[model samples]
Target: MDGRRSDTRERIRAVAMELFTERGYEKTSLREIAERLGVTKAALYYHFRTKEDIVASLSDDLRRGIDDIVSWADATPAGPERAQEILTRYGALLHGLGRDMVRFWHENQPAFRELGFGVGLRYQFRVLADLMTAPEHAPLAVFHARQALLALSWSISMMGDLPLDDDECYGAASAIASDILRRM
Candidate 1:
């Protein structure tokens, strides 16, 4: 797409996320998103047909990002060192996708479930967790691996109310996740 068109799509997504965060996915409408973006409903419609479409567009990007991570993990040998590296990489992926996208995903679980994004993300998490515990696939090891991943995700949603900023929260989660891996 052209630069202006891509920028419009991004602006729509960003405003939609803000409205979803403030008014909720179910409560927020296309008109509200358009008003927030200072665009007409027709213009917003040109980008996204519905609120679910907006969520799906963002979630699709996230799925592709996670898929890329999964592909990377699959190419590399599996071990604690690799798993730890995955956690670091996953943090970067989430941040690169934008905090608002992750936060909205956490907040609108029901909507995402309906849209199938939740299932896709959950599967991606399992694949990564299994990679963390690779070869053995031990239940306990997988448990710890999942916990480590959760630490990264929780940092996006749970830490929002905390006094810490994004970098601080991410640093704390990464440290805790690394420590969790050490236990396994």
Candidate 2:
């Protein structure tokens, strides 16, 4: 029963993300999400009462995912090689979340800003980058660290029009990110 309930919640989130991306967050209503899910509004409300709730839940999940990555990086020895591994794991996580949510985020910066999710994630991103570079923390090193992470993040949303698969995209992004880290 617990697993079934969790599955329903995930279904609601996936549908909501699809609707939010296809129609824009501002134009999407909870009714539309429920309609798309073939569920009643009340049924949808059992898991998420509002569109904001849906987005907040997704943001929370994403934050937790990032936090896990940061925790893993923190436990490892800091070095260029470690930085490359970090980028690989980060790309894998974003890919697991699918390209639509990432594209929605890239296309809807205003909505993300309004929700305040962008600021926290951005800060955490910089902190993780700093951790990856450690000790030296030179401006140029930090710049490269950020560029490496940004390349992985952007690859998901930016290359949507291309015919390449997710694994291929991740591989290309990982290679570029590794190159950036190497330059640092």
The per-prediction tally of clashing pairs is 0, 0
Model 1, range 1-184, lDDT digits (tens) per residue?
Answer: 6999999999998888888988899999899888988889999888899888888888888788888888998899988888888888888888677666778889889998888878878998999899888989999999999998898887777767778778787788888888888878
Q: Of the candidates shown, which would achieve the greatest lDDT relative to the real structure?
A: 2
Q: Per-residue lDDT tens digits of candidate 2, residues 33-116?
A: 999999999999899888888888888877888899888888888887777777777788788888888888788899889988
Model 2 alpha-carbon drift over 4 Å, by segment = none
User: How far does residue 25 in candidate 2 sit from its true spot (Å)?
Assistant: 0.8
Stretches of model 1 off by over 4 angstroms after superposition? none
Please report how far candidate 2 places residue 179 from its true position, in Å.
1.4
Question: Which TM-score value belongs to model 2?
Answer: 0.95
Candidate 2 has which clashing residue pairs, if any? none
